[model samples]
Target: MLDAGADYLLAAKANQPGLMGEIERFFADAPANLTSTVTEVDKGHGRVEERRVTVSTQIDWLSGDRRFPGEYRFPSIATIVKVQAQVYEKSRQSSQVRFYISSRSMTALQFAEAIRGHWAIENSLHWVLDVTFNEDAARSRTGHGPANMAVVRHFAINMVRSHNDKRSIKLRRNKAGRNPQYMAEIIRA
Candidate 1:
């Protein structure tokens, strides 16, 4: 991404155990002077959630030649971020912590907003596909079948969303499924 003149924020998952361990250790012993933090609270869906974001720009070591043998070098990493979320539901409470590496130098609040925006897309689009189309339960797993079906589903979603009716997407989908003329109208729309 840095070579392409684009900045990125990527989650440090367990697949890269070396990188994850390095980041975890850095944060575990990080000094106050090297980090910035922001916290936000939200209440909805019968839950109260709190998110705490911490960021640090002291990442020169990650790209330097002093790294351990066989350790991957991250280039132009201007910031590292940690997000800890606490969710309080009706009968239980849970917490999770996630780490991310960013090529851009941004403040803690900016990282928080960016992370929230990313999840907003997941919730709005993926969640809708799972609920309204049962995409997760699909049986097309061979060859190009899954990709082809995904395109068809996206096209159908676009057509349904473009129709004039204010009905729910599930209702519109059912109407189109049963009514050829209504389907034609939706296609025309």
Candidate 2:
């Protein structure tokens, strides 16, 4: 996909033979010794997560990856990514050497936080869109209609998220929309 117009945060899995081989080659012949630290985390209700930090001291794993003449300059990078995945019937946590290739520098904490933040939104808003808002099951087939409605929904969601309250954004929006006084506070805030 990187070769295509879209940019990529490429992930390397052990199942991929060629890419895995390349990664192993880099790890084995890495200029500076590399070490990986793995962490396993468990949360209640069929939720398990594993995080890993692969700190390469000298070798630039991205060196062999395609780059414009002088686009990338870093010799090495400190990479960390957290995976909170579940396999049904039971839950277990294990860390594996799954690789992620991104055109950004990230710290270990950053990776774990990013992964967690991603799920927070997914569980909250995206699920709401699918279940509550039915964004996915929308039947709008008109030109620009879906896009327009999507924009309006996002605007509403953002406005609600900007408010301060124990109530959820959706609930806050509902209450504020029902009351002029509450609406005024939203505008002022």
Candidate 3:
């Protein structure tokens, strides 16, 4: 990433157990003013989820030498982020915690926004391609078949999405499948 002059915000998962442990310890002993925090709540369909994000740049004590298991150094580690998600459904409640490292110095809200925006795009595209187009169930893996089919699906999605109608994508797709005039209108638009 440094070679490309680009910044990265990477999730710290089980693969980096040592790093994750260090991050947990760092946050546990963090000074009250050393980090910034932001919280968001979403409720729908009998489910409520609250996410709290905390970000800090106080990493002088979090060098590669401080980690256990192995000596691993991440270049340009500028911020450490912790996300705690609490979920409530009916009378049951659960919670999870996740960690991340970023090359950019960002506030907790900024990191949360960036992470949410990234997932929004990723989820939108994958859901459209998978549920709307059934792209994953396709057996066109030979040569350029997969690539060609993906391009065609993307073109169709773009065409349908570019229409002026306020209808959902699935509805628009269904209408286009049954009505030639509507399909023409979408293509023209």
Best by lDDT: 1
Q: Report the Cα lDDT for residue 189, model 3.
A: 96
In candidate 3 the C-alpha lDDT for residue 5 amounts to 88
> Each model's C-alpha lDDT?
0.91, 0.56, 0.90
Top TM-score prediction, candidate number: 1
- Write one digit per residue (lDDT tens) for candidate 1, span 52-81: 999999988677776466677677788989
What are the per-residue Cα lDDT tens digits for candidate 2 across 1-189? 434544334455655655556656666555433544335454556654445444333335446566554343323333423232433336443434555544445554555555557658768877766654568888877999989988887776666668787886667877887999998887777
User: Model 3, 12-113: lDDT tens per residue?
Assistant: 988888889989998998987999999999899899999999999988777545555476688889999999999999999999999999989988989999
TM-score of each: 0.83, 0.51, 0.67
Q: What are the root-mean-square deviations of the candidates from the true structure over C-alphas?
A: 2.8, 7.3, 4.7
Error of 1 at 4 (Å): 6.6
Clashes of each: 0, 0, 0
Give the least accurate 10-residue stretch of model 1, judged by summed lDDT.
Answer: 65-74
Mark the regions of model 2 whose C-alpha exceeds 4 Å error after superposition. Answer: 1-32, 52-61, 64-98, 103-110, 140-149, 163-167, 172-189
